[model samples]
Structures are given as structure tokens and as C-alpha cells.
Target: MIRRLARFRQRFGIAGRKVAVRTELAWYWRWLGILVILAAAFALAAWMYETGRRFAGFDQRELQQQIRELERQNGRVRDELKGTREELESLRAATAASESRLAIERSAQHKLAQQIKLLERENARLREELATFESLLASEARVSKPLSIHRLTVQPDVLPGEYRYRLLLLTGTGRREQQFQGRLELVVSLTEGGKDAMMVIPEATGDAAPAFRLSFKYFHRVEGSFRVSPKAKVKGVQVRVYEGKAAQARATADATIE
Candidate 1:
């Protein structure tokens, strides 16, 4: 190795009287080169680490932004859900109220139907009672022998000189429900020329027939109108019912004219 140095120094024109070769210096140079490579490697590793950290920080910020946006959307969804639930509750309340009203109406209808049925039953019972009373009265009437002039009425009519009369005759059980024919006469008293006068209804009306006729088993009603002199005022009425001739058995009814 000394010979190699001596030749290298001679070739480089660095010959000395005594040239010394340093083995230790060679070792130190080798160690220095290794240290320089290690420093470069360390610098490269540091740069890679800083770049990685910057990229990781950027990605983390983006992820945080996305998380915030997602949270806002979730909040809106929750609000909508709450509103829907509230509306549903309101609908349920309305439905419940309607159902309650419907139930009440149904109950009222049922009660009305019951009331109607009761009224119908009452009406039927009343009709049956009326029939029974009529039959009993008819039987009692058959057992009695009586005759009567039941009612008489007299009144002025529409025309100035006209008057009206009504008469009723009732016959009892003596006839045994047999029909009897009769004739009626009305005698009317009136003021004529400021003096009293009497007139028969048929004569006053100028009717050729002298009397009105009637026939009934139980009762008979007779009504008629007559006209007198226009200046005459009516005062009284007398009604007579004869079974045959005017002289035969008769019933009489009388009334004051008004």
C-alpha cells in the first residue's frame, strides 16, 4: 500500500523526500461518506413525513365538512317527521270526535223508533176502546123506550130576507132498532111591517110541498132555509116531528132565532 501511494504521488507531481501513507485518514473518510449518506436519507424521510401529514390534515377537514352537512340534513328530516306526527295526531282527534257524534245520532234514532212504536200501539188501543164503548152504548139504547126532540137551531142566512133552521130527533129502544119514517114542519115567527106574523117554512119558500121528510133508526137531523119579506126580522122557530099524520105521535123542538 505504501508503494501504491509513492507511485500515485509521483504521478501527481507531489513527490516528497519522505511520503507517509495514513490508514486512519482513509478510515475516517470512509466513515464521513457513510454519515453524509445517512443525513440525506434522514432529510428525505422527514420530507415524506411532512407531506403525508399535510395530506392527512386536508382529508380530515373535508371529512369534518361532510359530517356537518350530513348533520344539517338529518336535522331537517327530524323536523319533517315531527310535523307529520303532529298532523297525524290531529286527524286522529277529529276522527274520534266524528265517531262519537255518529254514535249519539244512532242512539237518538233508536229512541225515536221506540217512541213511534209506542204511539202506534197507543192509537190501536184507543181505537179498540172506542169500538167497545160504542157497542155498549148501542146495547143500552136498545133496552130503553124513549123518544125525544134532541136539538133545534135557527139562524139568519146569507141573503137579507133568508133564515135557516136545524132540528134533530132521537128515538129509543121501543123501536127495537127498527127504522121509523117521519115528516117535519117548521113554524117561524117574524116581524112583518112592525107587527108579529107566523109562517111555515115550505109556505114561506113558496114550495108546494107542505113538510120536509126524515127517517132514521136511532136519530135524524133536518136542515132547511126559508126566505121571508125583505123587511121582516125573524124572532123564533118551532120544529115538529110526526111519525105519520100531523095528528099522530110527535116530537117537538123549539129555538129562538138570532
Candidate 2:
């Protein structure tokens, strides 16, 4: 009986077995608790990350604001530059228009001056012609010669070595019954290379010979041009008129060049 009692005590003794006390929970409640702990850890990590960024002087909101302000400034500068370019173009256009108008005005003025000069020359020529007619009417004596030359002139033309000549031919009262058929000749006296020289216009057998043929009655005006060596200095010119098949000149006039 003692043995049996000892065996029972041993089986129930604390040294032989330790007992655990636990409260039973549902599976859902256990999962809920785990999720709550995870959420708290995530919140703490986010807070720490934000705090570190601030410590490092990297404020995202301020940086974004500065970028927007710079964009606005850039837009304003672009607008001003565009306006300046437009104004420059406008000024250039205005300047071009002004220059064009000035050129036109200058051209008109030049043309007006040229017309005035032509009118003045015409007036002088008319006055001289009127005086010649009046003198012819006043003369009582008839000319002895059948053909006579008057008012012969030789002058330098615009170009070098070019000369222009003009003359008036008057037929005597008896010669006016028939038209005078003749030819004109020019004797140009010049100095070249320190030597005296003479040249004849409308050289023999030249194409220009046709232009020297003359046909007129009463009074006739003769005008023509000739060219010579540019290096030569002209001294004097003489004009001669020849009738058909005549070897000698019928009329002659002399003019000195200055």
C-alpha cells in the first residue's frame, strides 16, 4: 500500500511533469493581430524616411515650386524677345520703304533737270534760226555764187575722239530753180606723235560714203558726226561741198577747234 501511494505521488508531482496554462483564440483573430503589427512597422519606416530627407535639405515641394517659377520666367523672356524681333522687322521695313521713296524722288528730279536742259537748248536754237531768217529777208543783193555755206561749226562730242559738225547751205536766187544734188566732205586737221596730219571722213570706197550724199533746195541744214584717233589733238576742220562728177569743191567752210 505504501508503494502504491508513492507511485501516485510521483505521477502527480511537479518535478515529474510541468503543466502549461493557455487561452484558446480563433484563427481570424490571430491573423488580425499579425496584420496590425505589420501596419505599425510600415508607418514607422515611412516617418523615418521622410525625416531623413528633410535632414538632407531635399524638400520636394519647394523644389517643384522653384521649377514652376523658372518656367514662368522663361515664358516671359521668350515673349519679350519675340516682341523685340517683331519691332526690329518693322523698323527694317520702314527703312527700306524710306530708301525706296528717296531713290524714286532722286530719279524724278534727275529726269526733270534733263528735260529743262533740253528745253533751254531748243529755245536757243529757235532764237538763232529766227535771227538768220530775218537777216536773209533784209538782204537786198543776191549771192553771186550758186551755192554758199554759212554758220559752219565743229565741236567735240561726248565720247573721246568723236566730233559733231553742223552747217547751213544757202542756194543763190538763180540756183533755187532746181534741187541741188551734191555730196559733203570733211577735212580733219590734227596733230599726232608731234606730227601734223589730215584725215578725210567717209574714206574712198567706204560704207559711210552713202551718208555724205546730199539733196536739197533753197536752204538746207547739215549735221553729222565723225570719229578719229583718241590720242590725236584736233586743230581745225574744213567742210567742202561737191556737185555731181565735179573734182573741185563748189562750196567750202573752215572752222577752228579749241
Candidate 3:
């Protein structure tokens, strides 16, 4: 009985053991508290980082504004560069067109110059013929030959080994009313293979015989071309006129090639 009483006192007495009284929280409230603590820690860390950046003379907002401005400037520069390239291409195309026009103009000018030269040569020839006619009229007595050749010219033609000949044939004034019928011949003197040679144009039995036939009155102009061996160099040419089937030449003219 004494032991049981001592045990009860020890169990219920103030000196036995201290007891803590606590209020129980709901599960949602506990979760809300934990979330608030985490939010506060993140806010404190962010604030510290922002303060450190400010102390180091760095501002995120200002840097971002600078980056945006630089991007705008870069876009403008690219546009300017593209415009410059387009202008360069346009200039190149215009230059090319101008060059082409210049070339065409040059070609036209060259052809015009050639035509002017030809006209000048024709004028000079006409003057020479006029002078010859005037002299013939002035000295009728000196022209004893019934038939004559004047201003015979032989020159190289455009092609190699080709030659062109021009001559004026005149009948005596006494025979002006009568038409003359004759044939023409050319004798070419040349040097071939280190030897002097002579060749006749319109060889006998050749198809060019009709071209040599002549029927004219008073005056006639004869112009023709002939070809020879390319290897031969012409030294001189002689023109002969024969009346009817006569073997002897009635009039002859000679021209030398230099």
C-alpha cells in the first residue's frame, strides 16, 4: 500500500515530467507556410543579386535598350548596303550599254569614212577623164591614129592573184558617125619561179571570149577583172584592140605595176 501510493504520486505530481501543449495545423495551412518560406528566400536572393549588379555599374534594362538600338542600327546598315549593291549593278548595266553604243557608233563612223574615200577617188577619176577629153578636143591634128586608148589602169583587185583593168577607147572624130566593131585582148607579163613569163587573158576557146567582144561608137569604157597564178607576180599589162578577125592589133596600150 505504501509503494502503490508512492507510484501514484510520482505519476501525477508536478515534478514527475513536464508536458508540452501544442495546437495542430491543417495540411493546407502547413503547405501554404512552406511555400511562403521558399518564396521569401527566392526574393531575398534575387534582391541581393540585383544589388550586386548595380554596385558593379551594370543595369539589365539599360543594356537591353542598348541591344535593341544596336539591332535597329544593324538593320538600317544592311538596308543601306543592299541599296548600294543595287545601285552598283544599275551603274554597271548602264556602262555596258554605253560601251555597246560606242562600239556601234565607231563601226558606223568607220563605214562612213570608207564611203567618203571611195567618193573622193571617183571624183578624181572623173576630173582626169575630163582633162583628157579637153586635150583631145584641143589637139585634133595631133590625133592621127584612127583608134586610140587612153587612161589605161591595171591594179590589184581584192583577192590574191586577181587584177582589175580599166581603159577608155576612142575613135577618131572623123569616124564618130560610124559604129566600130572589134575584140579586146590582155597580155599579162609576170615573173614566176625566177623566170619571166607572159600569159593571155581569155585564152582561146575559153568561155570568157564574149566579154572581149566590143561594139561601140566614138568612145567606150572597158572595165574587167582577171586572175592569174597566186605564185606569180605581175610586172606589166598590155591591152590590144583588133578590128574584125584581123590578126594585127590596131591600137595598144601598156600599164606598169609597181
Best of the candidates, lDDT: 3
lDDT (10s digit) by residue, model 3, range 1-258: 999989988988866888899999999999999999999999999999988897896879878999999999999999999999999999999999999999999999999999999999989988988888778756773257789998899999989999999999888877768889989999999999999999987786733388899999877889999999999999999999998788899899999999
Indicate the residue-level lDDT of 133 in model 1: 41
Q: Please tell me which model should have the higher lDDT, number 1 or number 2.
A: 2
In candidate 2, clashing pairs total 0
1-258 in candidate 1: lDDT tens per residue? Answer: 999987878877656466689666587889999999999999999888877877777455677898999999999999999999999999999999999999999999999999999999978965865664456447654356355664466888899988877655667667746788767777778898879999875553432353486767866556688788889988888876667554554766779866
- lDDT (Cα, tens digit) per residue for candidate 2, span 1-258: 999988888889765577799999999999999999999999999888877887887767777898999999999999999999999999999999999999999999999999999999988986997788567645643356788888899999999999999988888777768899988899999999999999987786633377798888888888889999999999999999998768799999999999
Q: Candidate 3: which pairs clash?
A: none
Task: Return the top candidate by TM-score.
Answer: 3
lDDT for model 2, on a 0 to 1 scale?
A: 0.87
For each candidate, the alpha-carbon lDDT, in order, equals: 0.74, 0.87, 0.90
Which portions of model 1 show Cα errors greater than 4 Å? 1-145, 203-211, 246-249
List ranges where model 3 is wrong by over 4 Å: 1-18, 26-32, 43-84, 141-143, 157-160, 194-197, 206-216, 243-248
What local lDDT does model 3 show for residue 170?
85
